[model samples]
Target: MIEYVARSGPPEAMNCPAFICDACRQQVVGAGIVTWATTIGDGRSRTHSQSPLYVAHKGECGRKVEAMLHAGYPASDGWIDLWDDIGDFLKQLTHNATNAFTDDADGEYHQHRLEGASTNGRMQ
Candidate 1:
């Protein structure tokens, strides 16, 4: 699995190590986040937790990634910009809503099971 983390600093501060965008292949400097992925093998997987595999693109390429998300491009396409605050907010909202539904379903299932058990005992 690959994960991209966002950095708060500006692009110029990222001088020593830089990230390149997988979509546009542009060098990412400054405020962009780093991405790390594990290399999968037949038996064992090599982890790149210490070393970043790619640097998220900022500036023009970053803009393009944001545009892709706005244009309905899927995150699976590697064009989704997760660093944006708005996107994170929306994701959180969706997660919360899903959790609420799951909670409701679980409550209903438990209630029905309890009712069924009580009725079964009484009939016996």
Candidate 2:
């Protein structure tokens, strides 16, 4: 339930058991770095309005558990949907940071630079 940034411990020092799901909580089955990015503005507005996200690492969105850990939130004691964790992340970031986001309601979903982007016009 507690996270430790050890200076002299395991190499990766995987996150605590609490930050993992029931499927992998007890094991460090796979390891990879988490990534995130935030963007702001809709329509024509321009500004930094979002925050980096660690939605998934190779299709694994462990962010929900990460956010909970960051806020000192304990595990739910039951299974939780990934989006529910996303909802919690959204609320926490909205309240804790000054960044803001807005949707243009133009049938378009926005993405931050890290939200699957590439050098060319084609999406990654």
Candidate 3:
């Protein structure tokens, strides 16, 4: 499944060396959004596969991603079931961004940490 996450930090400290916004095709220097996927196994056990990260700017670019997804844009490999709970995802994204903050001192950007909601309706 596809998921959205809000993160903030120095660009160099992110999981990727550089986050290229999938929507605007620009480098994300600070607070930005990330989309990835998680795979679960049967009840006996569970596993996860890391899908290609889809990063985007937190506000407008983030909205663009939502629009593309709604219009049936092709998702990354292993993200075949993106429509499962998109409405909820959009809510989470909007809430997170709306509540996020910025850091101007020393060029560090800080955004509020908002966890994604799991399929079970709990924060993940």
Candidate 4:
């Protein structure tokens, strides 16, 4: 099915039928949001004839589905797991940025300024 962003009109303006989100179980309707469809099983073990279509809110349910697929997990109830994943991902990003900063060694001297700073109860 063709998925296009609806620039105007109501949320339920889409001609397609509404469906519940696989992640949050929320009702998704209309053309503005994202539409998802997938076929179940591989042709090797099982036939790919089984296919299911769904409509979802792009920001909420759509993100959850994308994260689940990226992390290689089935859609589960609640957003706690997704939140945890996001937290971890953010932590990694911080770590990587920090590493990048530290890794940059220019010709300029990296000075540890202790002037006017108190150290061990005495100003250094």
lDDT of every model, 2 decimals: 0.39, 0.35, 0.48, 0.40
Best TM-score among the predictions, by candidate number:
3
Return the top candidate by lDDT.
3
Q: Per-residue alpha-carbon lDDT of model 3 for 1-124, expressed as tens digits?
A: 2233445686633343455676877776656766544343332443333334356677898777655543342344323322223344557768768665453344433222222434553223
Residues 10-110, candidate 4: write the lDDT tens digits: 66465543444556655544422332223343445643321122334557676766554434323341112222233343466578776765565762323
lDDT for each residue of candidate 2 in 2-65, tens digit (9 for 90 to 100) = 1232344566655442222322333223442333333344635543332222333223435543
Residue range 12-114, candidate 1, lDDT tens digits: 4433433456446555444554332222223324221111223345466556544543344333533223453333434665788777745665443221111
Of candidates 4 and 1, the better by lDDT: 4
The TM-score measured for candidate 4 stands at: 0.27
Task: Give the candidates in order of lDDT, highest first.
Answer: 3, 4, 1, 2
Error in Å for residue 55 of model 2? 7.3
| Segments in model 4 whose C-alpha atoms lie over 4 Å from true places | 1-17, 31-54, 73-124
What is the Å distance of residue 81 in model 4 from its true position?
A: 20
Residue 121 accuracy (lDDT) in model 3: 32
Pairwise lDDT winner, candidates 1 and 2: 1
| Candidate 4, run of 10 with poorest lDDT | 77-86
| CA RMSD (A), model 2 | 15.6
| C-alpha root-mean-square deviation, each candidate | 20.1, 15.6, 15.0, 23.2
